[model samples]
Target: MESVRTTTTRPAAWLMLGIVLVALNLRPSMAAVGPLLSAIRSDIPLSFSLASLLTMLPVTAMGLAMFFGLGISRRLGERRTVLLSLLVIGLASLSRLFLDSAPPLIASAVLAGIGIALIQALMPALIKSHFPDHVALCMGLYVTSIMGGAALAASLAPLVLLHGGSWREGLALWSALALFAAMAWQMQGAGSSPVAAAKAGRESFFSNARAWWLALFFGLGTASYTCVLAWLAPYCMEQGFSEQHAGLVLGFLTAMEVVAGLAVPAIANRSRDRRGVLGGLLVLIIAGFCGLILSPHHLGLLWPCLLGLGIGGLFPMSLIVSLDHLDDPQRAGGLTAFVQGIGYLIAGLSPLLAGFIRDRSGSFEGAWWSLTAVMALMLLMVLRFDPKHYARHIR
Candidate 1:
């Protein structure tokens, strides 16, 4: 395998565009379904437990698929792997158009999850290799696009249903976006590159204490995020908001995430260490969780905005912190894959558990309280994540 060069003599606008487009497709399939879930349940007659699986299955698949991403990238090359992932996303999303029952819908989610996992696992490396000089800027753009995609889908799904489309059509329309990304990626003509293999005698991240801490922090943070994504709109509807209005509130929350996703990284990048920043964000998350539990209906806009700001900052910062732990890009990448793999697996269970809580208690308050506890745990976890402590572990 040939090593891919990281430095380039000139800027590649096409490559950046392709990256943004691919990022845009990453969340719509999952996000859109959540807003329209009520309509879907009405059509398909699914129980709460099964309905929760709609989100859980894809997330769980993504978690599991992360372990395979590097191998797939090595075999197919990064460019081809990404292109194939896009094709899979497009086809899987298209399948939703005809899927009328829970089983097939869950199957489509699984397929989309595999594609998403591969692309997400591979993309940061692609960005680092192709846009070394502008890695932060490109990454901020990519992350913002992902949140923006979710916001757009959440905002649009309710409208799609209101305008005479079924839940199937609402979910399936995202395939067009995926197909567009596939075409755009192909036009870049990006060639494949060899993935760096792990050193022969290095200790596995699985056994490292700091690694698990980071993964736990990431998982807890994502649990809060996935829980809201899967349940917020339904919670709002139960509180007397219309489906379309609930969707808009959910959209607003994700839009705030887009804002923080772009801003927080740039702000954190200038600081010598992220401890203060991470601490402050966690405070905001705790406040948001409290607001939701105490008075969700009354403080509609405030709580979501606060939650979005905190989560948006936390997600990217966690990844950046992990990368900062190791100077070696390959080692950092490996730790990143490990963290996300475990983190996503843990995060995947959040919605399922939240749904069960909702079923048993007949309210989402318990779920929100559960998220608050998770965030509190995340706060404690970060105290142990001081970068100086991990200096000895650097390769």
Candidate 2:
């Protein structure tokens, strides 16, 4: 990897485009699964719990991969790491084209998850490093692109199936997007050398109670998201919606997420204390879950809209709150990575848990109720995040 030349005027624009493209590849592989889960199971014969692993396994891989993300970057270099990850993602998506049984399908999920994690684990610091003055803008774009990719996959996968493609074809279609992202990334990453990996473990916050709190907060917030991403389409189908409409619901939900991801942070930015905003987001989530449990078929769109805006806003806000704990970008990025790493591990099980509840209760209502309670718990937790204690907790 070579370094970018500051004197070159064209590099910045190209790099930003590359970052956006790379971010777009992160979620489609996993996101496409829920909308097509029933179809896949109809052919492949998986129980609800087993099918949940398609999402859970990859999420678990993402969590585990973060612990070793630095080692991969150190050995392969950041630029190559991103390219390699994109290639891995593309091949994993491509492999779904021939998947006959559940084993290989789950395996690809893990493989793609690992690939997504490698890129994600590197990107934050990369953005902070190269786009110093524009870190916020770049990060915003990167986060939005991730949700945007999920929206595309969710909305389009069913359309693909409707137009004579099998569920396998729908899953495999993301390979094309991955290919484009890889090509764009390679062009921008040319001559970009490997930078030194940040020393995140040096100032170890593993023992800090506050770090654990942040991790738990982020984890619960993420659990809500993973559960929905893995089950929303199927749940919609249960409520009597067709596959296309179910897909559209998830797609629209994620689109709302993209909007909130950008909008919520901008609004939150106006205040140093984020608790009020956090509480509002939690209320939206609780309301969304309640709507799903009580009135899914009647006011269906509103529930997803509420959930998406809440969870989407919560995702970035959790990281922002964590990042606020440290002054240094490297250290802050490290903490955010740590929170997400643990958070993913917690999150990976949520879809599986929801699946189990659905199996036992004969409906997804129990799971939604549980998530509502979690949101309520979060509302209580939000009160403790006083801005004045930021330094004391870390110190």
Give the 10-residue window scoring lowest on summed lDDT in candidate 2.
189-198
* Per-model TM values vs. the true structure: 0.95, 0.95
The sequence of per-residue lDDT tens digits that candidate 2 reaches over residues 112-210 is 999998887767766665766555456667788888899999999999999999999999989999889888877766333344453653446678899
lDDT of 2 at 302: 95
lDDT of 1 at 101: 77
Q: Which regions of candidate 2 deviate over 4 angstroms?
A: 1-11, 190-198, 201-203
lDDT of the candidates, in the order given: 0.81, 0.85
The positional error of residue 367 in candidate 1, measured at the CA in angstroms, is 0.7
